[model samples]
Target: MAKIAYILLCHKDPDAIISQAEQLTAAGDCMAIHFDARANAPDYVRIRSALKDNPNVTFAAKRIKCGWGEWSLVQATLNALQAAVAAFPRATHFYMLSGDCMAIKTAEYTHRFLDENDKDFIECHDFFESNWIKTGMKEDRLIYRHYFNERTQARRFYTSYELQKRFGLTRDIPEDLQVMIGSQWWCLRRRTIEMILDLLRQRRDVIQFFSTTWIPDETFFQTLVRHLIPKTEIENRTPTFLMFSDYGMPVTFYNDHYDMLLGQDYLFARKISPSAHDLKERLGVLYASEGVDFPISGEGRSLHAFLTGRGRVGRRFTQRFWEAGNTLGPERELFLIVCKKWHVAKRLVDQIALETDIPCVEYLFNEQETPLPDLGGIETTLTKRSRHRRSVVRMLFEYFGKDRLVLCLDPANLDVIEDFCGDTAKTRVLEIECEYSDDYLIGHARRVGLAGENSPSETVARLLPPIRNDLAHESELIRGAGIDGYQRIREAADRAENEAAITEFLGVDADKAQAVMRLDYLFSD
Candidate 1:
């Protein structure tokens, strides 16, 4: 078994830190913790008292006032890493982690996997060869000298930067020092940590240079590891998953994101919400378990498409449209069929799909969940995905092919119905304008087993309101789709005009739909 040492860098919430300390050290992996010097002393006191009884935990010797994009952050980490090394010299591997991070996999699995892989897991991209720092000043962060603290004294930091540029006070960085930058989180072999620490004792010039560079914590270990270690010995990936938002801020995980988190292959997840008690308690269970069952791979494409749009990058002009309107894929022909009677629309959809070469998908956004993609391998449920329905619909336009597809929808998806209606260029609305008796919905529900354990009257009562409300929008929906008039089929007395109108709108041969147009969808059985 591999003895692992964890370096925990924390700033706030003593209760959270204490709980995490207990859980992390549960498998006997020793931890060396460093509290930010600027945090409340009471918090540190509370944390120490809580974890003091645990043999696997230790505190760093020195605490420093750490700030964003400052050398003190690196100093604080160095303090913890050095302290952990001294306290647990037999530890085979050292992993860098933060207070908010929690293990997604079991400790036994992590230890066993690390024992097998001898290579270091850390991101170390060459600064000159890579476009690592994209947001702010690229290489200018290294070429300039930063004196005042960038976090607390922001005004002075900017003034000093401008002054250095005006006065030509830029310093020369050594050519031999291969400066690199990447994610701060990493896992390294004991030999790698010792070698870097030993070089830190000998290489004061390199340390002094990185001290003034912006966000050196992201660059310090990264640069040293790449420069010293052979490329074959590095994996160029972090053990901890730290996701960032578009604005360069950490994306925190919440209670609702449990299934999304578990589906991933990462060893640990970071920036977890402290208030997510359910997620926290569940994760605690998973962390202590002996074995894990990973879900079947490559399933949940429809579920994913429902939550997120089609996972494809659009071309230049379409890219802007995709971002602005939240639409994906090329323009395709979309036909929406709705009616006052649900079975009328459903019957037409089934017949069209059966008789013609065209694919007519029924009940797309209905409770039945169209085509019912196999979900035995998926963990997330439909209730959790209901919030993303519109996104699914918007992206579905692209997924349904660029030529044509006929679809059936209920009033529950009227918002999407209106969207399709608005895109008159490639979309057409076919509304069966007629007042059918309530018997159609009642019989159809019983035949399809939609009535479940309820009586037909009760099920129809439950399903009637949305249909009534949705059919009220017929004029607006058809008008938006550029359709001129209604195909009114009232009863057994009226069928000819409705059949002719449907045949003309569908552009199908009268011979194909002759029997389909004559049958009353309700009394056909």
Candidate 2:
């Protein structure tokens, strides 16, 4: 007799929501879906039309404009809870879900498990005691009042925060409530849900205080369920298996996650991409079937790591790559091959790869097609930030070991070249200026929608000298272009000795390669 009402909060993908809603109510359970007020009118209309005939399915009356990291999220959840209560009067428990979540377990299994447990399944962690917030802004979340949405309006959020700090302005939590944080997804006893709703009505002060705080949806019910329910009667965990990236965005599932998603222990897997039709269809069958539950793999390292990153060293590499700010560089010498033409640079890279045992990376800056024709990716390379450009360079140097890589630079990322080349300590700038920087500038202008801004000669005459001055100090200044430029770089790479080095050079061995690279970055500014 464990009647569950699943509250689904959705903004987009009506078809997926409809699919989930049908399966949910088909299992004899009820559902309340709250579509975001900001979502397309057509989408909302379509959802309502599809589910209108189902007696067990209902939509929340109030749809709030649910901005990310805003209090509106909690309000939407409350509205859905109210709708669920009214629509399913005999509900024994409430389960919070997102629109994109797919059930991995059969609906019958969920009902049976809930009946056996007979307790509120929710995560309620005291922030001070446990480190729950991965982004590391936990204390500030409750202690300060956030006027702007952190995710959407980062600059304004930080500005408001700084202003508050400057003026010594602060917000206080009520002494009666214990500040807690946890996942928003949960399954609560009907009594617990009713009590929380009643408390919101009676305690205007608490609601008012939480209204302006950042991401109150995470803490609002999380804190309350702990305050209301007895310790032993509640289970501090959620049934949904949700995962997020280092950037705090939810990890999306696709058609390829077929086996892992089906074999997972959780009742549901979250943030499924709209393109995941194959997996969704399979899960639909699983949801309706009376099949055996996947055995719980004993608690250990999880496959969640593979979901966000590539392989074994994924977490360590990501952490190292991003955290490296002042300490970003190769530990030894680096050979930097610079060119204005994409064809010349890519040609030299390929040639170098064949000639040497060392790692040769083409287009150190990512473009649509590094060695071939990818016009769109090439255009994106033109707008890429200097920091991102340099960060990847640092990542490669770190990954391959210093003096172990030869990176090719194209005018596609001209800013990174100018900035990086100025450092003659670790990097040796090898370039043959065949087309006087002006030729590259004019060609790039038309592609980037800047040709109309200035005539070719005027743009070059106004820019060439100063650009030359900036690069003159860094570049080796060889007077060659095209085929000659490619030939010159190849000859440089083929050499075994250098005037700057006392020892002979070898392609793979850094100890010997240092002779040809000559410059060391250890003391470089």
Candidate 3:
């Protein structure tokens, strides 16, 4: 068996770390851990005691006093890596990981994947050229020097940068070195590790230089590897998958993210907190199921597809809109729903928003008092009419660009949405109809309290067809089941009013039951 060495950098949640180590450790493989020196003494003791019996697990002798975005982080990683290599000399590959990370694939599969792939697996890109941090924004970490603030225990101030500006103090890196940045976690071959260690001994200045740089843990190894190794020897990928929030922090996984995690191609996921114990337990159960393998190789366009297969109705619906919204694609889409009053389609809008990364906005034309749907903490943005038209349009174009799908929910507000989106070829108009002459439709609509002087059904039907014809070049018409549709939507909404009822009616996990209810409008259509 080919031995794999794991270097885990830990600070908190010692029990979680022990559990993660237990999952990954094998007879030949070893897990070398580096707990932050600043961590509580009790935590350190607990971690040591828990893993004391495991011969494959060893704690680093030299623990760095680690701080966020500081040189100390790089030090801690270096200590862990050196210790891992020293302890497991026969180890074929060295895998860097965080304490909070959990393997998505089985240990056997992970080992097989490492054995099959010859190239080093490290997420890398030129810091200057790539927008790895986020879309359209250049990273400032490379351009500026980040000095660690000992008092704050973080990189909150740039003391060196301030002094450099005032005193014109500058230190230039060697012209031969190219700056590279990426995720701190990686997997390196034994040869690669030896080469890295050799470089460290030969060029002491490289360490001195990167030690002062901002978030050097992300940049140091990448710069060294790119500088030393052939392009073909490196694969610019990491086995660990992390979802980052808008603010550039890793989005913590919870029970709600269980399905999402299973869908990803990566072997590991990070920052699985104590609150996510339920999700962790569920994943353990899932792994015990037959036919499951590591690296989860199969034919499907999405993670959702891989896990659930292509035939399930819910998966089909999610995949359809995900494709429509260009999920995990280069071209991101914004679904703009224009309305004067909250329509049933708002539920669909919210569903699409939750099920994908696409930004979905509901622009209420003149209804400033309209209540924004409680997204329950989904990052969907809802804008009222308080902002100026030009400002809002500019903002939309700035963020989502001209590539958008504009759904004209109310024909009366079509002009408003069009003006905001600046109607382009990327824009697709959609009209929804709700009217029916059938008595069942009328009676159900009245019984559900959706009928008025001008029923939602009649108003939508009267206003929609003309607009659909006008934008027929780039639009689709979605007709509801009149009163029957409203009745179904109301039923779902009533059940979804409470958490337990939603779970019972939708027959989905508690986290997704509400979302499933909101998607009732889509089913009714």
Candidate 4:
């Protein structure tokens, strides 16, 4: 029999933790609860009472207050693991999980998978810059250098500076090491856990140093594992499915987000929620009554249960029209236009030009100076002016027929883009429906091979030769319309030279030199 433990640090959402516990127990797994010391003891007692029926569950003796970047979280985890190991001595492996996390696979499957790997599945996400450390402020207390004693500080500074300056820590580190952020959950073999505890015991100074600083949960595991075992012994991926979104925490995990989960190349659909209830019902009905093998519609996709009966007309139309039309195909070169208030759009456009090789344009309508209207019926002068400006901008895009393939990132302005181009063939127009934080957007772009090194202007200029050739017959007409074609040619050459210089400075080869040379050839003509 395989034994697994869940160390839950319940702060605000005890119910959520309890829900996960119920699921884990149902899968015939043991769980251990570790309520934070900062939590109300009375509430903790009540929570403990609620789980009294479960013999596997037990409250930990030691409790710690966890804060961001602080050692409290690590201490709590270490304490929990110690208690769990003592309680479940015969257990083969120990798994760590968070309260907010939902399991996408059964405990049996996870246990078997871990046993097969014979390795510790702890993610070591490497980050080059330590700028995130500076942001560790709480209640006006600066915690960036929190746990550093004089000797440790000297060692850390020497190591960090050497890594950053001489070795170029950011660039030299492997992608896995550079982005060593684990899922805050891991499964470790009994031997590995023992080794970690033994290391902690021997290196009291290092452990004590970590205790005063940020949660260092990720770093501690990563650094220790690297030291103890050969790099081959570590499994970089985890079995759990983590669903993330550009906006807030993912409310539901779906088929679309499954690929993001690092490991488990072969994953069955599991952990169905209320969001999937409607899809489940439809699948259940199809499987039970119709005796269908796949239970999927003609298009190899099944209808989701959560969306059932919510938008009947819309759903019917989606099933009949949109579903088939929206099938994913081979990747294509895409230009994303995120529409917003005119100023915001302009700023984002500048950033897009600077950061991405893909050409992205921004269209903003509202002026920043304008005051927003109150919820009450009273209309402010600034609000009226802003509304007027938006109307004018909307009219301009409509008249120019530039609405296709343009998305409005602002929720308030999305209707405009949708109203204009929603029914159009998706081949020419695509809408990014999800809200994305800047970090998430950047990360997503990087993951999808969209975050290229070149700026939009540079990429556009490189591709301009083909575009110019296509319009060669109309060049005279274009020139007659007061466009300085010669000036553009000269500018492209100058830009190419400047880019080559910049690449040399950055200690990198110019991969786009041929593309740049093509522009030079166009200019020479």
- Candidate number of the best TM-score: 1
Candidate 3 clashing pairs, residues 3+ apart or interchain: 263-303
* Sliding window of 10 residues with minimal summed lDDT for model 2: 479-488
Residue-level lDDT of model 1, residues 1-525, one tens digit each, is: 788888999999888888888887887788999999899999999999998899889999999988888988899999999999998978998888988888877887788778888889989888878887777776778999887776689899999999999998889786787888889988899999999999989989888898999888888999889888999999998877666654777878778656555555567888799899888888877777887764422212222332233222222222223334543234556667766456677777777777776667666555444563433322134442333443454444445433567776653344556555445335555666555356654554444433332332333465455334444554444445444432334345356666676676566777765655755564242
Clashes of each: 0, 1, 1, 23
lDDT of 2 by residue, 1-525 (tens): 788899999998888888889987888888999999999999999999999999999989889999878889999999999999988999998999988888888878888888889788888999678888766577777778888987888899999988888897887898788877889889999999999999888999888888888889888898898888898988888888777766778888888665555545578888777888888888888877896555543111133442233222212223225333533444445555666555665554555566565677766455544432223332245344233555455555566665556767653334444445443325444553334446665454444333332233333354345445544433432322211212233324323333222121222454544433343321121
User: Please, what is the TM-score per model?
Assistant: 0.63, 0.59, 0.59, 0.44
> When superposed on Cα atoms, how far off is each prediction in RMSD?
11.6, 16.5, 17.2, 21.6
Q: By descending TM-score, how would the candidates be arranged?
A: 1, 2, 3, 4
The list of candidate 4 runs beyond 4 A from truth reads: 125-144, 147-181, 243-525
Weakest ten-residue segment in model 1 by summed lDDT: 310-319
**Order of models, best lDDT first:** 1, 2, 3, 4
The C-alpha stretches of model 3 lying farther than 4 A from their native spots are 26-28, 133-146, 150-156, 284-525
Best by lDDT: 1
lDDT of residue 437 for candidate 4: 43
Higher-ranked by lDDT: 1 or 3 = 1
Instruction: Report the C-alpha displacement of residue 178, candidate 2, in angstroms.
Output: 0.7
